[model samples]
Target: MSTAHNAFPSQSATGAERGALRGALRGARAYWEMQKRCAIIAGSVNVLMLVVFHIAGLDALALFSVGSIAAYALAWLCLQRRHNRLAIGLMCAETVTHAGFGFLLAGPESGSHYYLLLFFPALFLGSSPRRAMLPAAAVLAAYVALDAWVYAFGPMALISPFDQALMRHFNSAIIIGMLSYLAIYYRKRVVSSERQLRAWAGSDPLTGLANRRHMDATIRALDADRRGGELAVLMADIDHFKSINDRFGHEGGDMVLRRVAEVIQGCVRDTDHVARWGGEEFLIILSATPLHQAAETAERIRRAVERIAFDELSCEGAPLRVTLTLGVAERAGQEALQATIRKADEYLYAGKHGGRNRVCRHADDPGRRALRQG
Candidate 1:
């Protein structure tokens, strides 16, 4: 298996999922850009705060204001380095220092005076909800402890006592709101987007079944753990499809292929997948069904295709008939997925040779069993 970080960025958004894809990228980029902006905003906020502290001759507050400016610059550098861990680490460090400095320089009268809310939006993106709360709660508790420590310390003059209590309450409300909004809205959107992307990667657009790539991926991904169902694979091809194209043109051929796709879909259970393997050929992945059952299913699709009538074409001065030939084999534990597909394709060719519109077993072709599917 490839590493998680490497493969995902190359994935394309399906037509249905463009909105979610845009939203995820936009949110992440906006969050990064916002981090960069925070340096300027926090620095300005600190400079203004320094002017106020200088008037009051609160030298410690001025010291903290300068420290905050330095921390913001360090934070900016961390983000630019693409060191996500270090960047978040800097943010956490700054959160602690700002809260502590507030308590040290001001007192409980100021509480956690350094805008604690600034970090919460970014936190919503970084970690899972269960894990995020741990960090957020840690930050909040640090602020509370610092406030308590300040209250126990010597006299200090800053915000009125009533204003301090009100600020602390407001901080608590904002934190709670952040938690609620992220859990209900942002997280749901992320999950929905992920599901849609998975479906896009897994499905064949023409027939709404697993694509060839998806079948290969799925085969490699199945675990060696307990499995109750027997496995069977069927490789199917539309009989005389090329002649149909020559006789009725490509559009009719496409229509016939589509109708055959519907017929194949109708023949199998929802659990099974019938993929358009390529032009006029399909790959059917079966679960719970053994070789014989898979063969029967393939025959059902064959008969369905043979019986389908393109009546609208009759009205248009031309009609078409389509039929399918299939090859079925059980998935042996010793055989790889591609190898099985090759085996099925050999039997499928045998069916076409012997007489189109029949099911053949790969074991019938002792010579071609070792051959590859093209």
Candidate 2:
């Protein structure tokens, strides 16, 4: 079996699920980007707060802002050196400490609790969901402790009602902005990962052709559309593929498959669909084509395969040669898609048995008639 089959299973149900899982969980690299953004935004916000508090003559709050700025600056340095864990620790500690000071000095009316809420989503940006749980629990414990402290004692300092409302609004805006950034970035990562996973699922890894499952879906979709156009199927097999594998081993066989697939693709138009059906066999769908035209195409493909020189592959000092036998069948009006494909497969084997490196169409086909007479 080709490595392609092992890489993407022909089973549709399992493949879809596996693809989704791989896509969803593959955002570890994006985490660092999120971390950097968070650090810059946090550091900037605290710098602004430092100026604002100093102007308002709140010396203690201004001092806390300096500490927040230093923490975030260190976090940025840690990130530069790729010390991600230390950076995350510094940022989390700074955020919790800042929120604690805000509530102690200016009270819960200042909406400092909103700052603490950032931890839930921020922690999830680190690595896997399971690993994020410990930090998430720690944040939860801190939140509960902060709430208990507020219940036991009130604010130690007082500020104007207008000042309290402004701080509340400012903190609310910051949390909202940060959360929105995380959401958008997370979505982009998931979407890109899913697209890549889907491509892998539908493609043959070795030849980069549509795999069997994807081809089957394409056929079914055409059947459902019921557009009044005739489509033709060509089932082609590499001539003496097993012998080639036996002579040159699986690696050489894989190379031949990829080369033949490229030749077949070159012979067909972009509108046509081609897939590595399985093993050494390929299936092609020629849209709006008649049986005779498809047969001509198959013959062209056969000639192209014959022309491919495996200069690097040799057995007993003779360079390797390759050829293909193809079967052509046109879909009848209202005929089942599978029935047409089966007919193509039958013709393909007929071509193989009658003589190799031939294109077999309907019995009345002139080339097929000549083959029988010879």
Candidate 3:
């Protein structure tokens, strides 16, 4: 690989981060997986509550913890079966029921109402905001009703101040832990989404090379910062591409395009910018390189392409062969980048009209010279 600095940002990540991002990319299914994880966490919290309440001789609350754990297990099973809607509905039911129990029996100091807030963002995970609205409003209504009931009648059962405070802190920690996990999950999703958007915006879908728009941007950036070094551009076109498409069909044509892109990419240094400049044309930009070196690179690409045997894309009894016609141009002092590109295009056509599988570097390039002599 040529060790040239790339104009685009790298999308590399650690294995764990990549896994998280990949999970995020799965949309609703990923959300369901996240919901299952939430269920497991909440169940674990209920187990702890079950132990604490049982030890404290709070039989009602301890019995309620057992029921909550069972509900969470059911929700987890629903998620496992891919019944996301049912699973989320079950979770919502458990949240409201548990919150009501805590407020009515254990009192407001227990902080169980915070559990109601967990599903607000979670509601949007498996659904659109509009679809999630009613459920979210129901959660809000439940919270409001619980608050009003507590204001009027107060706690139905009284516990020691010490036990109340301990429960309050325990509930707070659980909710806080859940919220922190959600924040991290959402952040990973956003990062993964941005990376995908960037790739779709900048790359060609068929060839996986930089598209014309990206190449234009790279050219402008390079021109603005010439760094007192030479810049070379090569415009290449597959010889008789339309004929190939006619013979082999679009799928075969696509395979050829992808293969040619790979070969061209391999011929250039890592820092060099290569783009699919629409249809069968490709553009390359070499930084800190002079005309001769660029011409040599173009010749190398031409030879490489010419030797490509399409073993899998045979015509009759023989394998298919492909070739490239390339034009090389170096950016002149203070010359507009577009002008250099046009010069390259002109030379590319010169190579095309002269014969086919050759590289043209100048007005007096061998292909053009041969044509003139002819």
Model 1, runs deviating above 4 Å: 1-160, 222-229, 243-253, 312-318, 362-374
Best by TM-score: 3
Candidate 2 residue runs with Cα over 4 Å from true position? 1-25, 47-81, 124-133, 147-153, 365-374
TM-score of 1: 0.53
Per-residue error (Å), model 2, residue 328: 1.7
lDDT of 1 at 74: 82
In candidate 1, what are the lDDT values of residues 1-374, reduced to their tens digit?
00111112222234336546765786676557656665555666667657755655667767777888887778888788877567667766776676667666556555454456545665656657887787778767876776676668743556655655654564455446545654565566668667867777676554566666787776665424227367788888887666666766666666776788888888898877667676678888787787888888888878888899897556347555667778788868756666777778778877776667778875645333433332
Of 2 and 3, which scores higher on TM-score? 3
Which 10-residue window in model 2 sums to the lowest lDDT?
1-10
**Candidate 1: what lDDT?**
0.67
lDDT of 3 by residue, 1-374 (tens): 11111111222123235545654566655576678889999899899989887765678989999999999999999988988779877887888888888888877887778888787778776678999999889878888898889889988787888888888888899889999998898788779777876776677767789987788898889878868488899999988887787888767777888899999999999989999887788999888889999999999999999889999888888899998999999999988888999989888877977887888888987667766666
| Candidate 3 lDDT trough over 10 residues, lowest sum | 1-10
